[model samples]
Target: MDVPRGFSAIESSAEIVNMPLSMCCDWQGFTYTMSGWHYLCEMLREYKLKPKNNYRKSILKKYYDKYQPYSTFECFLCEEEYDPLRHSTPWVPLPWESAFRIRLSDNQHFGPNSNTFIRKEFVRTISLYHRLESQGYQPQENKDGYIRGHFLKKGDDYRFKVSGGQHRMAALGVLGQKDLHVKIQPDWKRVIDIQHIHHWEHVKNGTYSEEAARKIFNFYFETTGIEKAKKYGLL
Candidate 1:
């Protein structure tokens, strides 16, 4: 994946842990695989996140399909969403995790007792995560010394999508972590219900066209430019 400009794997101060929602009931699982990562600029501000194009090929799409299977995340339909994973440059591999790179992408599904199929890139990246953890590394903290995500309310269902820290979240999962700390995305539901219209609440009008629906989203957040994106965007 391609990383953003000035993107670097620096220390995150949030003492947050993001885990899979499937840990609860009514979710699916798979054979555990390591995890993956890409260097990116630190999220200096708070706002919602989205992909630029190819929603069909986005990891965020994968996340939504996995977690918020029933609910409709209309905002995600924004064609202007930026795919952070799309512009990443793989950092040099660390040690231990790199050793297991050969075990990636087990297409045979032969691995056992895991939630995901281990892949080389994930093996290497998660290995770095653990390596840093071994050195007493900690997750960047929110204002409460904990980092988390916003949950979008779709009808009666609530969906929490990972914006910036997808790699870290997956790493913690493979390492068998629990007690992930996150807060709801502030104003998310309100933003969804803009214009006092349920239909306009999200981009669920059978398609996504940011140009046509920018007001619904842009009213509460910024679009997809660097300087303006972070003002209303999330990680």
Candidate 2:
């Protein structure tokens, strides 16, 4: 393959579905592998080294909001009922919705965005989805019901997180679908926490404001007629 000046061309066709332009040329990721492409993408996801907020924003701009929101409203990814505000039951503060997605195929970041966790069931679902995909079946997603999360510009790294679609994302990860859809809530930290999604009530430095809290409780009340929200845990 005739190569250019700076690009480290992937001569191996076994894994060379798309070629991402290298940072040596100051490009974001694969020139040919735009996110919408059916296969995995290769983008520079190394937010740790390049911690510049602009680069993080660029990733969000380039990859996020490409798809529309889901039409039908539901509580959270685990919940099935149509409850827009996710507070009906004291569901774990940080369940699947609190995870940040890491698309390993996107060569944008230098190393993997670490520390994100998922349920064991997530893996099983991925295998199922993979089998279905092999049978020529791809699932559907939308704006309202798609993965909602954030890729925050943090200390020498951008944190990839989730607001919904835990299982769907796991399937993508299992299938190596790096170039997929994302709804990045840049201010997600202010509203959610991946590390402490299950323990938010104890966090003092950043807590969901009363108005937001009330709104969620209101959702709970509307769904199940519960007036009081859960109490804040002891510090």
Candidate 3:
């Protein structure tokens, strides 16, 4: 687990209450244990961390998988598409009402990376937004004060890739309702980073084939210099 770059522990707690401590701990542990900084350097050496690579990784495969068949749908939006055979009433750790992340690019060319599990979880989030809106959740006026300006990570530019709560945002956009408040409690980035790293590691290690790994690795690492070969010591 890597201590997410931008925010400090104190700032994290004060700014976002729901920030996942487990994620923070995991990131800190991984970087400390694994000597992960060298991976960043290697990526720079290979030129695999370019923005073009990241764009390809994040966008292309997502479009492909969206067209592929999925097995289940645990949330509202996906409830219509996929089925929950067993655990008919199983619940996820995160609740429906919690303030979560949502990326601006969704299902489009530069949608969230498929390697990130948060993308799948977010399918249900759209329905949550619909539910809230249907129940007469009013829009806010001073939207700038809302959670729109939150950073993805300390060092990373651009907003954090939203793991959930996208539908609410879209509804607000469609309604031209800037008054809605988007709250961000940042904890998942550590976990997300872990997942991102693990997925590529699996790919590079031959657990997942080269084809599947290529798009995924290139997408996230392109801009960040997060290469599988360097990060996992394959090089």
Candidate 4:
């Protein structure tokens, strides 16, 4: 599979170590880990916030409307008549839809799909939480035997960006596991420079200058990253 210019598949032997859960991040390099599911679990536990299916649809429609503009392709959600599942061409999200999904994930609103998938994930997250709580997180049980990712170091602070086993990582996080056994790839530092991560965060927070953020974003994701960032006003 082709990756971005600045990214590569994990090819080197990974070093396994126990690292703090708070230091781990999702694939987008964000510190927020399964926050949406966490929120759902909390609501269920504390407030019994279960609404009817129609009510759920009403809530999800708001999110769909908000993120639909960011979609570039004629997916089933956007096009009233087009159905990619039946078409000869396999549909994939373009940069715009990808950007839309990122924002949706950040807000704990999984979409570009119906509420069914989101609800399924919520159920799965709950299942995972119970399994981890009972099973005690055995690394050997996982196919990879560990949560796989790479460590990004900015000065003394480190963040592990998960490349695999995100669901399990999120489960551990939700369970309040302070640390995890992780497999850190050796080539991450060479592919994703720490400075790039720093600049990206600065861009997200509107702390970095546009010119500088563009340069770093371009390096990380080529022109497409810059375009998405600008479209979302992150740069």
Candidate 5:
């Protein structure tokens, strides 16, 4: 299948839009803790480094133990383990993973078992949370700088998916900001009426079948988008 690219690379063509925090979600369309905002908020509130580390470890261990067996590979760049089974719920790999596939694959240092890797990731998340909280959200002067995302529309309803600046979004969420200004590409209002946006997370988390996911993907994305999904054995 040749899935046509839905997101644009040119940043100048993008526009900023204000959306409610309740309608915002991570790249995979998950909100709150599943979207990782809760964890980021917890780290921001905890002053003691040891407690933060413990908290991070516990969270990672819980998810890792449950999902690691299904993960085909883990990417430290985003501090996520990629399980084709879960990610390919809709028969397409997450856009960021597809874009950074080479870098992610080459940068797999010490798998999930290494404490050093865990500690480094924990520290990185904490640093990002603190930096955004203290310095405030500064939109980078690049395509990847802003809180970039896209709107998934289903009839009259819409949801914003944060494709970039996830940590910054989480920080802002903790700071009690209800309205978010998100940078979106020219093709931002892509219709995805195959299903409700809230059901997307359920699809990614393995609650939905691949058959259903394929139906959704075929409805929303073009044939060209599945090349990466095929490469990841998602087909």
Candidate 6:
């Protein structure tokens, strides 16, 4: 029995080895690679899965260019690729750029400016200008030109004493100009009488209720007017 069993009597065995390796991470959700860290994106060559379409591919390319590993915790506003970041502002109308003649007269006038409708009008004008330009019309003049004035800080918390561009300035703020740098046009001083007209009517004629004026003033002093109507509370 021993002689016959020789090789047949012995047997070999293999054991499965389990290492402490981490899960795999994906590159732009294309190809996935093994790594200890999450939110991983690999080199472009290593990109595995093709985008669903050309749009997706384009988006991926844009994301690849500006994306940094540490930016995961940052706000989208901090990204240069953000939509708002596309336009540099206090956007001046260029010579070649076609736009409508936006004049201060075409807009409503107010002192220390009205919080209402100013933003709406500014946005409307800009939007129209963009549309017209797209259609190949050039604006010969900007009637609704703005004037610039720096804040002459009065005291603690520094109240701004209406230096210039009261209406257009309010409009710009409402329109959200973080990079606005255009100087305020100098002619705003000539329009002071017209400016006071709106205020006189509203304040004296009571076009705006006393309660409304108080609320509007309080809202402006408090928030950036982004959430004014919603955040406003009556005393």
The model with the greater TM-score, 4 or 5, is 5
Candidate 1 versus the native: TM-score? 0.31
Candidate 6 off by > 4 Å: 1-146, 149-177, 182-221, 231-235
Write the residue-wise lDDT of candidate 5 on 1-235 in tens digits.
2222222212123366556666666543335332232334444445344553473455433332322322222211122334455555322343312222322221222123455555555566667767766776666554556787776554445566666766676667666666655667444443343454335544556544545443433322222213322333322
Ranking by lDDT: 5, 4, 3, 1, 2, 6
lDDT against the true structure, each candidate: 0.29, 0.29, 0.31, 0.45, 0.45, 0.25
Model 1 agreement with the true structure over 1-235: per-residue lDDT tens digits: 3221110111222223343433211001121122212111111000013323332333322332232211112222332333335312222111101111212223211122123432333344445555635742254433333334443232333333433344454444444554355433343331122243335422344132334444333322322222222222312
Better of 3 and 4 by lDDT: 4
Q: Write the per-residue lDDT of candidate 2 for residues 2-115, one digit (tens) a residue.
A: 322112221221211121211100111111112221111211232223434343343322332231112111221122332346434332232223433334322222222222
- Report the C-alpha lDDT of model 4 over 1-235, residue by residue, as the tens digit: 2322111223333366666666565543323233322223332232224433332444333333333433222221223322345333323232111222334342343345556665665566557767888998898676766777765444444455666666677667656677766666544442244455434444445333445333332322222122322333333
Per-model TM-score on C-alpha atoms: 0.31, 0.27, 0.27, 0.50, 0.53, 0.22
When summed lDDT is taken over every stretch of 10 residues in candidate 5, the lowest stretch is 102-111
**Consecutive 10-residue window with the lowest summed lDDT within model 6:** 19-28
Clashes of 4: 0
Error of 1 at 133 (Å): 5.1
Question: Candidate 1 — worst ten consecutive residues by lDDT sum?
Answer: 39-48
**Which is superior by TM-score, 1 or 3?**
1
Find the 10 residues in a row with the least total lDDT in model 3. 24-33
Give lDDT: candidate 6, residue 165: 34
How much is 22 displaced in model 3, in angstroms? 28
lDDT of 4 at 178: 76
Which is the better candidate, 2 or 4, if ranked by lDDT? 4
* Top candidate by lDDT: 5
- Residues 1-235, candidate 3: write the lDDT tens digits: 2333333432443332222211211110111012222221222222223433442243234332432312212211123322245323223122111232323333331223354443343334334445655764433443432332232222332223333333443333333342333334444322233234334444445333444333332333333212322332343
